[model samples]
Target: MHPMLNIAIRAVRQAGNIMTKYYEKMDSIESKQKGYHEFMTYVEKETRYQMIAIILKSYPQHTIITTDNNTMHTGDQHVQWIINALDGSINYIKRLPHFSISIAIRIKGRSEIAVVYDPIRNELFRAWRGHGTQLNGYRLRGGMVRDLEKAILSTNCSFKMNPNASPYIKIIEKIFTQCADFRRHGSVALDLAYIASGRIDGYLAINLAPCDFAAGELLIREAGGLVTDLTGSHDYFYNGNFVSGNVRIVKALLAHIRVK
Candidate 1:
């Protein structure tokens, strides 16, 4: 693993420990949205505080982008840490063991590293620009499921409010009619990691943000999974939409959509 990627993995594991320490505690839960509850507990806050402090201390000049609503940076530097300190907040609040701490670094608007830690499972997924994806230091790759009729897929319902969601759904609805099964776990970070680990055959989403996908994109590619815009372009980062899977199946899924 790259030295920077090693640091990223450490940070993600540390954040996972912090978050897990507070998991399933009734006192820390709070409502955040119509369909969401949050644990913005001291654990989440302090973990991010520590992670960001560590990043700034080590890479003082690099700008940090996060989901905390606490920091923002313009497009000035060549490096940025895009993070969702606590993803699957609703699941976390419900004590469902599905949340994660997602951290990815984008250099010049392109993802170069990403680390996501599944606290409940103690599974750590990490990838660097040229290195293959890894799970606990072992190399990984997407699964070999050629037919959508035999593939397991995932998507996010939260994306429905976006402009592309309808069309994206139109494509996915077809998958439901043809694929083996589909699921929505509410965490894009984990979904991408699952693709890299071969836990899911393919994944699609609309309105995914840079912080939401940058790391996962590189990881999926490194893991030998195919990723592209729904329209078959490789420019998924800017397009805000992507469909990824085992190489052969990804090609088939991409054939189902036309988006730019």
Candidate 2:
């Protein structure tokens, strides 16, 4: 692992430890709503703080982007650390074991290192731009299934972000008819991680924040898959509408996705 990637692993593991502690006391953690289906907890705040603190200790000049808007710090350095200390707060609050911590380092607009840690599963998915993606320590080469009718697609649209359900619903309707089945695991970061690990063959979602998919996006690309917007563009970071999987399935999914 790269030194910075190793540091990220340590930082994420520290956050995971905090999460495990809170998992045993979910009833006491107070949470507030940010939107209809969006929420946060004191644990999320502390986790973000812990991650940034650990990261800044080594790269004090690097830019940091977390869910906390107040912690946004800009510097002359070219590296940026994007983090989501608690990726699935809703799931975590419900004592579901599907949440994760996402950490990624971008240099000059390119994601060079990425890590997604699922404490519940003890699965760490890591990737570097030119290097292959890994789960535990085994490298992934995407999924073996290429037929659209047999592929399992994953998404978060069922949660219905932004109340603009029409676009998402229409696109999903088309996908449901072709793909074997679909999954909504509540965590887009983990959904993308599943794609990298070949647990799922494809994934799509709209209105995703950069913190949610930045790391997993790199993981999918490094695992020999395609990551692109619904219109088949590489500008997923800007639009937050993305589809990713093995090249064949991604291409087929794009055909059924109506990019309104």
Candidate 3:
């Protein structure tokens, strides 16, 4: 593993340990809504703090961008860390055990490392640019479900926050008709990891933050899959939309989306 990626792995694991300490007592964690269909808890805040400390201890000069509503940048830097200390907060609060800690390192405008750790399953999904995606050190080649009719696609219901979900709903309805099935896992990071591991053939969503897909995007691409925004561009970091999968499935999914 690249030295930076190794540091990231250590960071995520330590953070996962912190989260797991609170997992069993999450029901008493005190929570609030961040927005429509969104939730946050004190656990997230504490975990983010510890994770940031771990990363900075190793590379204090790196820039850090996080979804905790915190952004820090200083000095000349070629590397930046994008993180979601706790992805799938709702699932975590609901005791679903499907949440994860996501961390991705972007160097000089290009993503070079990614890690998503599911504490419940003790599964770690990781990738480095030009290196294969791995699950607990085993390399993954992604899925081969090219035929749209037989592919399983995953998405999130965050469209509820959008003024009009009809257009997005239309896209889902169309996909349901053509694909074997679709899922809304509530964790965009895990959804994309599943895509890379071949557990799912594709994933799509809109109005997501950079922290939501940064790690997953690199994992999918490194695992021999493709990722892009609805516009078929690789600029999802700014656009906050995604459609990722094997080349054939992504193109097929894109053909069905008629975003107004």
Candidate 4:
């Protein structure tokens, strides 16, 4: 294992311990609203703090970026550690046991290593650039479905009085009619990880931060999957609209997702 990846695994496992602890005392936890339909809790903050401490202890000069916009720039800007301490805060708040911690290391603006740990299920998904994705030490090879009609797709859509809700709904309606089934899971990290693990055939989401899918993106790609925007372009990283699946399934999905 790479030294940096080892440190990341340690940091993520430590953060998982914090999550499991707070999960047991959910009633005593307090949360604050950060934005429209977004919540943050002490658990998320503390987990990030602990992970940062562990990481900086080894590489104090590396840049660290968190979902809360608290960026730590110590020295090197070429290497960035993007973190989402808690990916599914809504699920965690509601005791849904479907949240995860996502960590991705970008070296020279390229994703080099990634990790996504689910505390509730004790499942750790990881990938190192060219070295394929793994779940609990087992190699993953992504989904095998070659057509949307036989594929199980997952999505994360915001429908709470949003201006783009109409187009988003239209995209979903079109895809749902063609796919085998659709799931609206709360965590994009887990959804992508599931795609890498072949548990789900494809995924779609809109308006997401880099921390939400950075780690999982590498995982999917390493596991032999592709990630693209709804328009089948590579601009998902810029537009925050993501679609991912095996090659054929992704192309099939893109045909039905029309946005203007």
For model 3, how does the per-residue alpha-carbon lDDT over 68-90 read when each residue is reduced to its tens digit? 43685453368889989999887
Q: In what order do the candidates fall by lDDT, top score first?
A: 4, 2, 3, 1
For residues 1-260, write the lDDT of model 1, one tens digit per residue.
Answer: 56667667777777877777767444533423322333455556777877776776677777888773335544447888887777887777677778788788878767788898888999888888787889888989778788888999998755455664676667777767878989899788899999998899999887677777777878898898888887788777776788888877877777666423
List model 4 lDDT by residue over 169-232, tens digit each: 8788878889899987899999999999999999989888889899999999999999999778
Instruction: Tell how far residue 220 is off in model 1, in angstroms.
Output: 0.5
lDDT of 2 by residue, 150-222 (tens): 9999988874545578868878888899999999988989999999888999998888888989999999999
| Top TM-score model | 4
Give the TM-score of each candidate: 0.87, 0.92, 0.91, 0.92
| Pairs that collide, model 1 | none
Candidate 3 — which residues are off by over 4 angstroms?
27-40, 73-77, 158-162, 258-260
**Candidate 3 Cα RMSD after full superposition onto the native fold (Å):** 3.2
In angstroms, what RMSD does candidate 4 have relative to the true structure? 3.0
Q: Which ten residues in a row have the lowest lDDT in candidate 1?
A: 29-38
Clashing pairs in 4: none
Error (Å) of candidate 3 at residue 228 is: 1.3
Clashes of each: 0, 0, 0, 0
Highest lDDT: give the candidate number: 4
The models' CA-based lDDT, in order, is 0.77, 0.86, 0.85, 0.88
